[model samples]
Target: MSPPGATRGQPAARSRRRAARVAAVAAGLLLALLLCEALGWPFLRGPVERAAARATASVVSIEAPFRVRFVFSPQLQAGRIVVAAAHGMALPHLVDAHALRADWRWGDIRRWRDGAPLRLEALRARTLDARLQRLADGRASWQLGQRRAPPAGEAALPRFGLLTLDEGHIEIDDHALALRATVDLSGSEGEGGRGIEARARGQYRGHDLDLRAHATAALPLLDESEQAPALPVRLEGKVGQVVLAFDGRAAALLTGRRLDGTLRMQGPSLAAVGAPLGLALPATPAFELVGRLAHDAGVWHLVAESATVGSSRLTGDFRYDGTREPGRLDGRLGGERLALADLGPAVGAPGTAAAPPPPGAPPPRVLPQREFDLPQLRGMDAEVQVAIAELDFGTEALAPVRQLRARVRLDDAVLRLEALSGVVGGGRVDGWSALDARQTPARWSVDLNFDRVAIDQWIRALRRGGAGDDPRRALLTGVLEGRLVLAGRGRSTAQILGSADGDGRLLLRRGTVSHLLTEAAGIDLAQALGVLVRGDEALPLRCARLEFGVEDGLVVPRVAVIDNRDSTVFVDGRASLADETLALRAQVRPKDFSVLSLRTPVLIGGHFSRPQVGLQASRLVGRAAAAIALGVLAAPLAALLPFVDPGSGDGPDPCTAAPRSAAAAAASAPRR
Candidate 1:
């Protein structure tokens, strides 16, 4: 206090002593914290409960024996714990446990905080009850706190190294799946190894469900050792008339990380089986399928060994990847034969298992009217190639298609069929088609071409005469070629066709027509009588050409003509696709001389379902007057000449000029 230097030294010493005291107190507090941690810190139960309740947004309570310790890893034990549901949840409680214990690794906790899955070292529970629920709007009762973004990797589930449970009950109610189930679960440990078994009773998609499952204990699932065995699992379940069974082995259950199994299912309809899984499977007749199923990461593979739907059979390998933003399906499917009728349900045709319409409802329409599920198409992408040796149309009028192949692709609600080729009626068809479901009402377009088709084979005679008659007699014989380009917008096939606008043309070369029909058209009484007395014969044709233009579902003939050795027939017609009606007139111009002839036109009219044919009354009246006046004023020969033709068939071949005109018109037309 007296000297200046002494005062500065005294202040420094006091500061050093104060700092030493602070260090000692810090050391003592750390030592006490270590001791408490080793003893599980039972006295901190209230604080722990409060922290858990705040974290879960639920009411958490624990009875005596509650304890927690955190040195490097965390350990928890409690007696008679109860966790109430989060606010706004329908259920009152999420979990009620008579006894519960859990342990976790320090590294796993840190990894979980950094977006990795949390792994538990051990879990043991007794008399536990847990309830889980999911609403249609995607709210889940078990979801705690705010929702977080999904992890970057596979959405992995928590794993456990060792698990023991007794008298456990689990209930699940999922509105999206229309499923409500209650399960009784138990676990066992023995020399044979740990195992888990469960029995469930529920209702799924309006069907009563009964299920049983068994699997190797959850402990091995957490083991990453090379020597660990794959968990063996077996599940058998039935929902109403549908039966499902699976026997498999997996690296981890319910994760689809790695799985190998045999899956077998049989149901009244495939639609029913897919209902609870939210798959838009096509409606089908009673069916059964057995396949080798495997999964890795988020992809599923199925190699169908045998699949039968009604009388149809198919086998293929299919791959489905659900990890992408929009799921994708890729597959190559083929079979020896496929019945078109069996696939009717896919295009809205009524299957054999379909229920009849109500008594008061109108009969089903001829064209398919079921609207497409456009939203479902946006949920997935696909590229599938199909090939079939034979495709049966299920009708005697149309021959079976052979060597059918097509590549189908779907992306962003747009469906396209490319590289489409098939052989039918001894003809080749090549084309491409597309449906843009992204557009309202869905726009559709098709450009198809038919080449080198045998017309006679497609138009067979309905009746047969004696053995002496030719069995191959047909209405017409020719090599035909045609093209069609059309576009429309609608939700169903009928509506699409009703609004279609297009142009088309047909060409038949080196063909023949019915001799009797040709003679009757020209009213060649002598030749017609002679042909009728004998048998009908085939008359060689020069050529036939038909071209049409369509506008707003109305088709009008631009050129319709048939040229043969004896006569040239001209056809004028208009067909209404909207009302399904027909109106036509045919006039025959005789190319040869005939004594008795009536130059009258033929009229054809009616609905597509019922057509009427008769002579044109106005034309017949004019012809009659001309004949009568000629007979009165001049000789009978002169009178007959007015009604007969004096050979006008020697003109320039119209067939030669028609093709050139058609080509020019096509070239000048605007392209879509």
Candidate 2:
């Protein structure tokens, strides 16, 4: 009111004072910042290292040349960080990194004030190389809680929304597996879409492996959909010589939930492809697979559209649930013309033909000579039913089988083959078998029943490639019916056979015996019987039956009888599986008598692999004594001679007595 400019001047002075006060505060903040920068005030160095150490369960250190940037935002950059392994000092170095940088943004600070989730802007590392190991004592380096308790919780956990790596590598050595790999990764938003890409080169279990993957998160992470976020992914890889490709959508990659895909795989051999994936296979078979695959939680399922193994084509639906140890495999596999030899190796049999033995060499042992790997049995649990329209053994091997079907179940180191049935050798074969692997070695039991098998066809097939001069070839023709029940405990075929105890029966009905028997028993019996026993053609085999029992590898005959129009023969013998030795006695009785018709009892004795036949002096002498005794009583017993006549022995039928005789033999056999 006194001067008009006075009020304005006073207001201007107040404004200048406020401006000066702001300037002073700004200067003070700048000075404080300078001091902090010099002293490395955030000394985040210690905290960062301790956090890393706690997270890795290891010792950690960061070599300094540390720097902090505060121009536009707070950031820290480091060089040459290392994390020590929790186990195995045998290694020269554990984990190392050339450069590490972390970015901080204002959004994170703002979110912290509102109690929202915290996120990092970026985390970038270059040339990081690390090794994770487990010692023989079961201590692991990559596993958490192995060293000390993580430093009091939440602070040690770093939440990074995005991570980038360049020229990075990691190696893992653990009890279950061994791995090493180089990795490169990048993610960014582009005109096309938001995508993450990764590439890896590695060796797994000594197999070369390569992988490429791309994933696009089509739905926003914060989208308010009740449905889970969908991540569409494409993958291509190779392990050894096997190639694999998959295109799929996953709910979450890390959690591996709700995964659906089409997977394609092809390789020269299943063995090579499955080696790295830990898929157990019996032999190196060429294989191809195309399947619709899915994963839910810990279970993986495959609907196989087409699968091929070797020359067999198969289609099946299979599942593997790895939610627990001794995980389960369930499937039904059906195919056409599966080769038994192809599966023979899985059961500890030779997968290929043996080299021919030298001339005059003894026949190969019946039991397997190769070692059996017992560990292959305890790898998993499975219930698979198999049906093959036909099964083939190579022409040079054995008879073909048809209508083969079986159900196989394996649980807790025990395997059962149930409801096994097939048609082979002109007969129906049915049986069940069980194998128990919980013992130090192993135990096995089997019951095989053969119904009315054509013995002549079996003989032809069995002797197809043998020497033509072999006297046993084509020597018998009959219908054979039998049952074999056996059990044993051992680690190998030989050991099992040595420990075997069983009963076996053979009944030959309405067939002929070849003239080779005449030579086998020596020409004396043939000439004594008649006209060289029906003129060198096979003799009429009226009836023949043999029964035996086994105990501790010894084979003892219960009853052996062979009858023909010309003569009757009986044999008693004991064979040793342990030593492959045999001792047998044969008594021949001619229907008609000539002075030359007097027959000497023949003996068959030697190793099974090299049996020998000759006349036995002791048996011949005993027969002569019996003849003399009969002559002394001939006049007094003339009226009853017809009852004791060898012809009278051939009653209505001899085979009628087979069952009773066989059962008696089995009941009397020594029990272990």
Candidate 3:
């Protein structure tokens, strides 16, 4: 039989066994808790969402419930994402995405522990839409205005291994830019792992646009070492009628080296590209271009293999450097038979359209009133050389050109046209002009020399609109040479012309002046002598010299003489540029006279808008003897001359190969 003490020992041993089992279970639970902490358990999603909300208070906010799920990886997600704007209004968000999710992969856990790169494997969103704006104050919604913590002292950026986007749409309505697009994204983990590809259909700058791009980088994308593989990239799109394609390899984005690319562009008009950007450029039809692009140290260089603008073909190299203040551009370009009017809009002149005057009042004058934006002029330095075989000016009012060459330099709002030379109206034309705009108002100066140009052609080329028909058109018929020097200060062309002061000279060779001019001016001796032959005859023009001084916006004739062997005529006048008025007196003497023996001076006075002529007998009261001597000499000479000779010349040609004005000769001297 068992003893009573033995039964009590059995029950105590059973209790000990149960106690040990409970202790073992508690130890297992403690181990599991430690693992969850290290792996970032989804149960902590509430804290993660709150931390995110605090970090992005200025840029974004979370409105929907935060939740976490465990799948292939731990994912923290939100139901609604709203971008934060000023005033704490979250209803109209800059960006709105739904079911946004992001997760760190298990593969990155070892790297995180080893101090290697910690990468987020995937970030995803569905039905995203965004808007970007720039205010008149120059503040931009897309730009991070808040100062970013310097990377020098901040933690490194976590690499984004993949991004998957679906049904994404974005609209950007900014002061200077506009875009609307639908975007799609995908990625893979093979040879192109860590690469994301995107396709977009949109409208940009008022043009239909489609774009596809692929980007891939070295394993550790932030590395700058020599062993890093070059980032591979490609872009293709259409902007308006222009089709653009680019294939290139480049340093990573933050490297500041945008280099190594082949670019192609073709379009019906280059203006299509510039118009959307508010750049002033004229139409260029049938344009095509190809170039190699490279950039290093903030300098971009483009070497054009071929380019065509309008009817001209061109080749050149262009460079822009922005590494230093006052960015610079240097280029050399040459073309043949270019339509210069295709570049007219770039001149920045305002259009002309005048309102009609009431009743018989004078016509309204059109003046340039466009505001000059000096900030753009002060931003860069430019040096360019251009050569063209022929430059078509696109109007009979402007001279046709040949062999045009120009060297242009712009520095700090000062523009200099150096070595500007061209052949126009069958003569060599050369000049230099300078415009200084560094001050509140601008100042300008011009010196021009025209050598042996046909006077008839020159007169035909002078435009007649606000200035009225050119009076010289009725008097000029042969080759002439002249010089003009002018200087003024103002912000616009009309103001400058009104304030200008200059000197000018003109020397004419063999030519003829219209008889109607002399008759209408009522010079009696000239009329009788012409009537001795016929009323329809033009007077022989042998030689003439016009020398004038400009001061206070008035052109004052110092010495004006027109002569042939039979008669000599002199004129004194002041033409007002400020008020467009004319005040002039003319005296004519016939070398010979008829029995009538009538002699009188003529007066011409009126606004240039409508000139008037009158006879001034009172002004000739004391010059009878001189008139008699002129009559006697002219009578004999008249018998020798024949009437109805419809040729250009009536006397010996006085024009020479050299410059006729001393001031012009000096101004035309070779530059040092």
RMSD of each candidate relative to the true structure: 9.8, 8.8, 10.7
Candidate 1 per-residue C-alpha lDDT over 1-672 given as tens digits, one digit per residue, 9 for 90 to 100:
379888879889988998888888888889889878877798989998998777666788888788787876688999978887544577867778887897888887667656555467877788778776666665655555424423222233345676678877877676755768787778853335457786678887777888777876643432322333477878788866789888988664322356689989899877776555334455777888899888776687888788887777777788888778687879987877778887777666667645666776654345566776666667778888988888877666656778989998889888888999999658898899998989998988999998988766654442134222353455567888999888888887767777888888888987788878898976677778888899887778789988877767766667778888888887766776776766777788888777667767777776664677888787778878887898889977666766665656656665555432433433433221
Model 1 TM-score (2 dp): 0.72
How much is the lDDT of residue 437 in candidate 1? 89
Q: What's the distance in Å from true for residue 603, model 1?
A: 3.1
Scored by lDDT, the top model is 1
Q: Please, what is the TM-score per model?
A: 0.72, 0.65, 0.60
For candidate 3, the TM-score is 0.60
- lDDT for 294 in candidate 3 is 77
Worst 10 residues of 2 by lDDT: 149-158
Clashing pairs in 1: none
Candidate 2 C-alpha lDDT tens digits along 59-111: 77887767766557667677877767554356545667778776778777466
Error of 1 at 61 (Å): 5.4
Greater-TM-score candidate between 1 and 3? 1
Models sorted by TM-score, best on top:
1, 2, 3
Candidate 2, residue 393: how far the Cα is off, in Å: 3.9
Rank list by lDDT:
1, 2, 3
Which candidate leads the pack in TM-score? 1
Q: On lDDT, who's better, 1 or 2?
A: 1
C-alpha lDDT of all candidate models, in order? 0.72, 0.64, 0.60
* Model 3, backbone clash pairs (residues 3+ apart or across chains), number: 6
